[model samples]
Structure formats: C-alpha cells, structure tokens
Target: MAGLTAAAPVGQPQMLTVVLEGLRSHKGQILVCVTRSADHFPDCTKDPDKRHFAVPVKNGPIPLGTVAPGDYAIAIVHDENGNGKLDTFMGIPREGVGFSRNPVLRFGAPSFGSASFSVAGAPVEQAIRLKYFL
Candidate 1:
C-alpha cells in the first residue's frame, strides 16, 4: 500500500481578489487599500503592513493578488474626472466610489469595521458596487 504525504498546514497565506463593479465611468482610477493593521479608519496614510495597489481603470475588475490572510478593507474611488483624488463637494463625493461588502454607505465613507472582512487559508472573491451622486 502506498502512503500519502502529510498535507500542508491549514494556516497558509492566501490571496483575496477584489472585484470593483458598476463603475459610473471608466475614465478615472481605482485604488485598493488593504492592510492587516486596523489602528485607524482608512489607514492608508501609514505604510501598509501588507500590500496596496492602485490601478488605472478602463473598466471591469482589477485583481490584487497574493494578499495575506487576515482582516482587510477595500476602498475604491472612481475619479471620473481623473483628478487623482476623490473629489468632494460640501462633504459629499463628486465622483463614484465603493467599499467592500457594499456596506450601507452614509453621508461619507463607512468605518473600517463596517467594510472589513476576513480571508482564511484559501483565496476569496468580493464584488463592490460603485456608489455615485450627481
């Protein structure tokens, strides 16, 4: 009888692919903010403990790969005007934006916990619906 080798440990690192959809327009950019450190909401200011990727959008999902397994939040801004930043007017975003899990977005961006989710030993998929206001 042949004996099988032991399998790898269950806690191996994995990637979490996030898909941003329903973009109002494809003329802008897409920024993905991911981290295991949750010291602050939208904690993009400090150097991310893991990975961060910003992709110019022409349309459709932008894949961010090889992300470690842990808590993470995905924030995306559809800068329709190509301003290189989220344009806001009177405390409201002038461009389309999105968050992971599609949490109930209020007058402004949602808190880190509201948009956070866990990735375990295997890859995960998520789709965020873009929010827009004229």
Candidate 2:
C-alpha cells in the first residue's frame, strides 16, 4: 500500500465580502462593521469583529473575511482624515458613509432591518454605494 495519509480537511471560515463603490477620493481608511445586533448597527465600538481597510482616495471594493455566516447589517465610513472616526458637521456627516442595501438617508441612519442581509454557509458579497455630503 502506498503512503496511507489521513488528514482532516480544513473548513473554510464563514465570511462576508463587502464591495464598496463611489469612494470619491483615495485618501482615507474605510471603517466597516458587521453587526448581528441592531442595538449597535452603525457604531461598531460594541462589535469586536469590525474590519478596517485603507483604501485609495479612489473607488474600489473591500472584502471582509472575519465575519461568520449569519444575518448581519453593515455600515461603512470613509475617514478621509485617517482620524479613525466619522466626522459630522452640525448633526450631519461630513465624510463619505454608506450602509448595506444602500438605503436612503432621511433624518438619521437606517434601521438595522433595513440594512440587514442574510449570509448562509456560502460567501456573501454586499455592494454598498458610498455617499458623501461634503
């Protein structure tokens, strides 16, 4: 018998890919948060699995590989100043920001349900269009 080798097959980590477009500029870091809870929809301070990507001031797509397969909502902010925080002017955002499903921003951020998407065992790709107010 040839070399009988038995190795446990490694399973792929469940993850969600976010394709960000309309970046407008290429001079900041993109802060992406995947949340399974509505209580912390946009603010990812409570989420320990937030993914941050440094993108050019140009438009591109970002993939997040740290998320598990489950229902989750996504929020992204382009910190042009690299301050690691979303800048707002008079209760309005001054930088590029967007959410999953590309929900229209009315008075405030979209609800968790409005920006939520289901992720099964397969890899999921979410396309979000970044919007800037400045």
Q: Each prediction's TM-score against the native?
A: 0.81, 0.80
lDDT, candidate 2, 1-134, per-residue tens: 69965432234446567778887777877877778888888886776655544544445445677565567888989898989888999989999899999999888899999999876546667889888987
The lDDT for every candidate, in the order shown, is 0.72, 0.77
**Which 10 consecutive positions of candidate 1 have the poorest summed lDDT?**
1-10
Residue pairs clashing in model 2 are 25-57, 25-58, 26-56, 26-57, 26-58, 27-57
Q: After superposing candidate 2, which stretches have Cα over 4 Å from the reference?
A: 1-13, 48-60
Clashing pairs in 1: none
Model 2's alpha-carbon lDDT is: 0.77
**What is every candidate's alpha-carbon RMSD to the true fold?**
4.3, 6.3
Candidate 2 positional error at 115, Å: 0.2
